[model samples]
Target: MPLEIAIAGGGVGGMAAAIALQNQGHNVTIFEQARAFGRIGADVNLTPNAVHALDGLGIGDRLRATAARPEFRISRTWDSGEETSRLPMSAAAEVKYGAPQLTIHRADLLAALESALLPDTLHFGARVAGVSQTEDGVTLTFADGSTGDYDLVIGADGIHSAIRHALYGADDPQFTGLVSYRGVFVRGEAPDLPNLDSFTKWWGPTSDLQIVTFPLNRGEEVFVFATTGQKDWTEEGWTLSGDIDELRDIYKDFHPEARALLDACTEVTRSALHVRAPMPRWSEGRVVLLGDAAHPMVPFMAQGACMASEDAVVLGCALEGVEAEGLPAALERFAESRIPRTTRVQEGSLANDWLKKGGNADWVYGYDAWGALKYEVV
Candidate 1:
C-alpha cells in the first residue's frame, strides 16, 4: 500500500527521498523551515556513488548538463607548488564506476532534485518542533503550534535535528577544532589562476589545514573550501559572513597559486566543523532519521552529502509496497543496510586520509545503492 509520509527539513536528502518515494507510488510531503530556497552553499562534489543514486532518481542528465566534469584531482604542497598526486577523473571515473563524477554548485544540485518532486509536495516555513509516534502513526508539531499526522516521519533536519532530539535525549556535537571558509567566484575572475581546470588541493603542514578549489557550473565558476585550526568558535550557524582578510592571513604562507584563488574571492562564509558519533540505531517506532541527523561527520572525505543521497534511495526501496503494520520493520531494514556503510564513512572522514597522495578510492566511490537493495527481500 502507498503510505502517507512526511519529511521534515526539505534539504538535498529530504527532497531526494521525496523523489524516490514518489517514484515508488507513495504520497509524500516535505516541510521546510526556510521560506524559500536560495542560491546558498558553495560547491558540492557528486562522486560516482552519489551520481548513480541520482541517476536512478531520473535527474542524471539534468545535473550533468550544468555540473563541471573535472578531468583530474590534483594535490600539491602548501608552499612549494610541487605536485604530489594526480588522480584521473571525468571519463576515467565513469568507465570505472558506471557513473560520471561531477562538481556542481550546491544550489544547482538542490534545484535538480526539486525539479523531480511533484507539485504541492513541499511546505515552507514549517519548522518541526516535536514528533511523537502512536501505535500506527506519527504526529509532528510545528513551531506555529500546528500539528499533522502521517504514517511515517523522516527526520532529514541535519545535525541539530529536532526529531532526533525528541526521540533520543540531547547529543551535543563535538567541535573538530577546525574552521572552514568557503566562497564561490566566476571562473573569469581568476583567469590567471593555475590548475583551475581540475579539482585541486594544497596541503598545509597538518591534516586539518588545507585549501581545496574546484570548478562548478560547467567550468564557469570556481569554489574554494579552506580549513584551518581554531581553538574556539561560538557561532551557532553554518553560513556566517567570513572575513576575507583574515582568511588570506591564515593561508599567507601558501603557494602563490593558492593565494591567487583566495584573492579572487569577493565574499566568503565561515563555519566551525563539528561531528557526532554514529547512533546505535536510526529509527525509533514510526519516526526515523536520515543524513546528518543519524550520522554527522567531518567533511574530510567529501562523502557527507553522498551518504545522505544513498540513504534516500535505500529507504525508498525498504518501504516500497509495505503495509502500515510492517513500517517499523521496513525502517529497521533500511537502517541495517545503511548503518555499517555510513559508519565506516563517518570514521574514515574523521581520519581525513582520503586520496591525500592518490590512494585507492574504489571502496568509497564504487558503491551502487540501487544494486545493494535490488536483491533484498522486503
Candidate 2:
C-alpha cells in the first residue's frame, strides 16, 4: 500500500530519500526551509559504495557523465611531497566494487536529483518549527502556524535538524577545533598540476594541516580543500569568506602540487568543523532520523553524504512492503541495522582520516550497498 511520506530538509540526503521512497510508489514530499533548491558545499565524492546506491536511483549514468572518475588515489607529505600511499581507482575500483569512484560539484549532483523527482515534489520555504506525534501518524508545525500530517516523517534536515530537537531536545554539536579552506577552480585556470585525473591528498606531519585535491566536471575544474588549526570558531554554518593570501601562505612551503591547486582558487570558502554525538535512538514512533541528523560523522572518511545515501536506500528497503501494519517494526529494524553500521563509520571517521593507515580501505570502499539493502526482515 502506498503511503504519504514527508521529509524535512531538501539536502542531498533528503533528496536521496525522496528518490528512493518515490521509486516505491509512495507519495513523497520534501519540505525545505529555503525558498529555492541549492547545494552548499565544496564538492562531493561517491566512492563505489555510494555509486551503487546512485545506480539504484537510476541516475548513475547521468552522474557519471558530469563527474570526474579519478584514475588513482594518491597521498603525499605536506611539505616534502614524499609519496606516502597509493591505490588504483578507475579500473581497479570497478573490478573490486563494481562501480567507479566519482567526484562532482555538489550543485551538479543536486540538479540531477532535482530533475529525477516528479513535478512539485519539493515545497521550498516550508520552515518546520516543531513536530507532534499522534497515534496514527506525525504532524509537522511550520513556522507560519500551519500544520501537515503524514503517515511517516523523515528527518533528513541535517545535523542541526529541528525535527531531531523536537524529538530528543537540545543536542548541541561540538566543534572539532579545525578550520578548512575550500574552493573550485576551472581546469584552464589551474597551474597544470599533476594528478589532475586523480584523487590526491597531502598531510601535515602531525595532522595539523591537510589538503585534498581532485578533478570535477569531467576535468573541467579542480576541487581544493585545505585544513588547518583555528582555535576560535565563533561562526555558525558551513561557509565563510576565506582569505586567499592567508590560506596560500599557510601551505607556501608545501609541495608545488598542493600550492598549484591552492593558487588556482579564485573564490575560497571555509567552515569550522563540528560533529554531533551519536543518538542512541534514531527513531521515535512514526518519526525517524536519517543522514546527518542521526549520525553526523567527521569528514575523515568522506562518508558523511555517502552514509546518508546508504541510509535512504536501507530505509526504503526496510519499508519495502506490509504498509501501516508493519511500518513501526520495519522502521525499528532499519534503525537497528544502521546504528552499528553507521556508528562504526562515525567512530572511525572521528578517530582519524580514512587514509591514516596508508589508504588500505577495502572494507570502506569495497562494501556493496545494493546487496545490503536486499536484506530480508528477520
Candidate 3:
C-alpha cells in the first residue's frame, strides 16, 4: 500500500526523506517555507556515513563528481600555528568505512537532492503553520491558512521547527554557547589563501573558532566556515550579514594562511548555535518528526544531514510490509531504530565542542552511516 505523506521543510533532510519515500512507491508532498531552495551556507563535510546514504539514493557518483575528496584533515593552534595532529581521511577512510568523506557546497548538494525529486512534488513558500492527527490520518495547516490531510505527516523542519513546537511543546532550544560565522570565497581570487583541498580546523582556548574550506560546483566556488562566540546570536535566516573585520580581529593570532583565509572571505553570515536534548518521542499518532525536528544536535560532528538521510531510508524500510494496524508499529520501530544511534551522534557532536578542535579526530571522522544502517536494520 502506498502512503500519502506530507513533509514539512524541503531542506537536505526533508528532500532526502521525500526522495526515499517516493522511491519506495509512496506519495510524498514536501512543503518548504522558503520561496526557493538555495541555502546560503558554506561547505558541508559529508562523511563516508553520509556518502553511503547518498549511494542508496543513486546520486553518490554525482555527488562525488561535484565534491572534493580531501586527502587529510588536520588541526592547528590559533596563536602558535602549530600542527597538533592530522587524520589522513582520504588515504585510510575508505578502507575503514567503505566510503570517502566529501566536502561540497550546500547549494550544489541541495540541488542534487532536489533534482532527484519528482516534478512539482516540492511546494516552496508553503510554511507549515500547524499539524494535527486523528485516528485515520494527519492534517497539515499552512501559514497561508490552507489545510490538507494525509496518511502521514513528517516534520523535517529545521531547528526552531514549527512542527516540533506544535508536537512536542514550546521549550526553547538550548544555546550551546557557540556562534558560527560562515562565508564563501573564490580560489583564484584569494591567491594568498591556504590550500583548502583538505578540511582543516584551528582550535583556541576559551572562545573557540574554526575555518573549513572546500570546492563546489566544479571548483568554481569555495565554501568557508568561521565559528566563534556570539553573545547576541539571533533567529535570523542564513543571509544575515556578518562582519569580516570582526572575524579577522578574532583570528588575528591564527596561522598566516588561516588569517588570509578569513581576510579573503567576502560573503559572511553569522548565527547562534543551538543544541537540543534527545526528544522523549519522535512520533505521535500519524504525525512524526524527522531530521532536526526530532534530533537537532551541535554541528561539531557534522552528522545532522547524515542522520536525516538515515532517517528517510529507515522510515521507508519500516513502512514496508505493514498493514493499517502496523502503521503505528512501523513508526514505533522507526523511532526505536533511530533514537539510540542519533543519540550517539548527538552526544558525540556535543563532546566535540569541548575537545580541542585542531586535534586529529579519526574516531569522529571514521564512521560508516551505510554500514550502521545495515546493522540497525538487520
lDDT of 2 by residue, 209-242 (tens): 8888888999888888888888887987667889
Ranking by lDDT: 1, 2, 3
- Model 3: per-residue lDDT, tens digit, 135-172? 88888998889999899888899888888888878978
Instruction: Evaluate model 1: give its TM-score.
Output: 0.97
Candidate 2 at residue 343, lDDT? 88
lDDT of 3: 0.76
- Residue 318 miss distance in model 1 (angstroms): 1.1
Query: lDDT per residue, candidate 1, 114-206, as tens digits?
Result: 999999999898999999988979999999899999999999999999999999989899999998999988999979877787888888888
Can you rank all candidates by TM-score, best first? Answer: 1, 2, 3
Which ten residues in a row are the worst by lDDT in model 1? 352-361
TM-score of each: 0.97, 0.96, 0.90
> Whole-model Cα lDDT per candidate?
0.90, 0.84, 0.76
Best by TM-score: 1
Candidate 3 at 249: error in angstroms?
Answer: 1.1
- Residue ranges of candidate 1 with Cα displaced over 4 Å: 375-378
